[model samples]
Target: MTIHVIDTGFFKLDGGAMFGVVPKSIWNKQNPADENNLCTWAMRCLLIEDGDRLILIDTGMGDKQDAKFFSYYDPHGDATLQSSIANAGFQPADITDVILTHLHFDHVGGAVHFSSDGSQLLPTFPNATYWSNEAHWDWAVNPNPREKASFLKENIYPIKESRQLKFISGDSPFANIDFIMVDGHTEQMMLPVIHYQDKKIIYAADLLPSSFHIPIPWVMSYDMRPLQSMTEKTNVLQNAVNEGHILFFEHDPIYQAALVEQTEKGIRIKERAALIEFL
Candidate 1:
C-alpha cells in the first residue's frame, strides 16, 4: 500500500474562528495571522493506493465558486485537485472511492466541478463512488443557518445525481481499512483508520485538523458542539498514543503527519514528519 499527500492549495480563515476559545495571544504564535486576522491553511487531501483501489480522501475547495464568494476567504496556491491526482500517477477516473470526512465546502468542494461554459455541475471523479455517512448527508442537505453557508449545494447533490454516491457504515469493509464516526464537528463525520504497510494511520479530518489543535481546549469555534469535540479529541488522542499510530493531518500546512505522546501539558504532538517515513 502507498499513501500520497494531495495538496489542492492553501486558503485563509479567520484565526479566531479556527481556534475557538483559544486566545489570539496563543494561536497567533502558531499560525500568525494577516492584517485582517486571517491565517493561511492548506486544503490538503490524501490519496491511498491499496492494490487496484485508489481512494481519495477529502477533496479541497474546488475552483467553482464566484469571485465574490472567494474574496471572503483568500484561496491561493499552485497545487490543484487534478494536478495532485496526477502527481500520484493517476487521474480522477482512477479513484475508486472518495471518503469524505465531512461535507463542509473546503473539505468536499473539489468533489464536483462546473461543466463547460459553467452551465451544469458535474462530479469531478465520475467513476469513483463518493462516500459520506447517511446522518451527515441529511444534515448537510438541510443545514441550519450557522452552517448553511459552508454546506453549498453546488459541491454536493451532483454525486447523487451522477449515481456515484456510497455510504460507508462505521466498520471495516476489508482488513486494510476501518472507519470511525465523530459528531462534534458535524453529525457523523467519518475518519478513516487504514492499516497500511504494517502501520495504522488515522486521517484526522476536522477532529484534529492540525498538530496545533492537538490540545484539548484548542477546539475550533466552527464545531457545532465544542464539548463533544473535546470528548472526541481525548478519545482519539489516547488511542493514537497507546498504539503509536501515525496521524495524517488534513489542514496543517507545515506538518504532514505526526506521532502523539502524553506530555506534561496533556496530549501533545511528539514529532512531526512526513507520512512516507512511516511507510
Candidate 2:
C-alpha cells in the first residue's frame, strides 16, 4: 500500500474554540494566535493506493463558498484537492473511493463541486463511490442546532443527489482498512485504521485533531459532548501507546503525525515528524 498527503490548504479558526477550556496562556504557547485570536490549521487529507483502489480520506473544505462566507474563515494556500491528487500522479476520475470521516464542511466540502458551466453542483470524483455512515449522514442532513452551521447543504446534498453516496456499517469494505466509531466529536464519526506493513496508522480525524490534543483535557469546544471526548481520547491514546500506532493528524498546522507513550505525566507525544519519516 502507498499513501500520499493531500494538502488542500490552510484556514483560520478561533483558538479558544479549538482548545476548549484550555487557557490562552497555555495553548497560545503551543499554537500562537493572530491579533484576532484565530489560529491557522491545515486541512490535510490522505490518499491511499492499494491494488486498483485509489481512496481519498476526507476532502478539505472546497472553494465554493461566497466571499462573505470565506471572509470569516480566511482559507488560504496554494495546494488544492485537485492539484494535490494530480501531484500524486492521479486525477479525480481515477479515484475509486472517497472515505469521509464526517460531514462537517471542512472535511467533506471538497467532495462536491460546481460543474464547469456553474449551472449544477456535482460530485468532485464523478466515478468514485463516496463512503459515509448512515448515522452520521442522518445527523448531518437533519443537523441539530449546535452543529447546523458546520453541516452546510452545498457541501453534502449534492453527493446523494448524484447517487454516489454509500453507507458502511459493521465491517469496512476495503482490504487492510477498518473503521472505529466514536461519538464524542460527533455522532458516529468514522476513523479509518490503515494496516500498512508492520504499522497501524489511525486517521485521527476530529477525535484527535492534532498532536497538541493528545492530553485528555484538551477537548475542542466544538464537540457536542466534551466529557465524552475526553473518554474517547483516553481509550484511543491507551491503544496507541500499547500497540505503537501512528496517529495521522488532519488539522495540525505543523506536524503531520506522531507516536504516543505512557509518560510520567499521562500519555504524551513520543515523537512528532512528517508521515514519511514514520513510514
Candidate 3:
C-alpha cells in the first residue's frame, strides 16, 4: 500500500481556543500567534492507495464559504484538495472512500461542493463512499450551539443526500486501517490507525493535532469535554509509546510526523521527520 500526504492548505484560528488552558506565554513558544492573535495551522489530509482502493482521510475546509466567513479564519495557501490529489497522479473521481475524522468544516468541508453554475450542493468525490459514524452523523446534523458554527450544512448533508455516504456501525471503515474513537474533541471523532509497511502509523486527526499537543494537559478549549480529552490523550499517548506508533499530525504547520518516547516529563517526541520517511 502507498500513502500520500494531501496538502489542502492552511488557515488561522485563535491560539487561545486551540491551546485551551495552556498559557499563551507557553503555547506561543511552541506555535507563535500573529499580531491578530491567530495561529496558522495546516489542514492536512492523508490518502491510502491499496490494490483497487483509494481512501482519503479528512477533506480540508473547501472554498465554498463566503468571503466574510473566510475573513475570520484567514485561509491562505496555494495547495488545494483537488490539486494535491492531481499532484499524486489522481483525481477526485479516483477516491473510493473518504474517512472523515469528524464533521468539522476544516475536516469535511471539501467532501461536498457547489455544483456547476453554483445552483446546488454536491458530493466532491463522485465515486467515493463518504464515511462517518452514525453517532457523529447525528451529532453533526443536529449540532449543539457551541459546534453549530463549525458544522456547516453545505459542507455536509450532500454526501448523504447524494446517496454516497456510509456509516461505520460496528464495522471496519476501510482496509489496512483501524478506527480509534475519541470523544474529547468532538463526539466519536475517528482516528485512523493505519498498518503500513509493518509500521503502526496513526492519522492523528484532532486527537493529537500537533506534536505540541502531545502533552496531556494541552487540550483545546473548543473541546466539549476537556477532562475527557486529557484522559483520552493520555491513554493514546501511552499506547502510542508502548506500540511505537508514528503519529501523522493534521494541523502542524511544519513537522509532518513524529515518534513518541515515555520521558520523565511524560510522553514526548523521540524523533520527528517528513511523512515520506515514515511511509
**How many clashes (backbone N, Cα, C below 3 Å) per candidate?**
0, 0, 0
Candidates' lDDT values, in order? 0.90, 0.96, 0.91
- Give per-residue CA lDDT, model 3, range 50-129, as digits (tens): 88999999999999999999999999899999999999999999999999999999999999888889999999989999
lDDT of 1 by residue, 168-206 (tens): 774655458798899999999988898986688999999
What TM-score should be assigned to candidate 3?
0.98
Q: How close is candidate 2 to the true structure, as a TM-score?
A: 0.99
Q: Per TM-score, what order, best first?
A: 2, 3, 1
Clashes of 1: 0
lDDT of 2 by residue, 56-173 (tens): 9999999888999999999999999999999999999999999999999999999989998999999999899999999999999999999999999999999999999999987789
Best by lDDT: 2
lDDT of 3 at 97: 94
Q: On lDDT, who's better, 1 or 2? A: 2
**lDDT score for residue 108 of model 3:** 91
- Give the least accurate 10-residue stretch of model 1, judged by summed lDDT: 166-175
Global Cα lDDT for candidate 2: 0.96
Candidate 1 ranges with C-alpha deviation above 4 Å: none
The candidate that wins on TM-score is 2
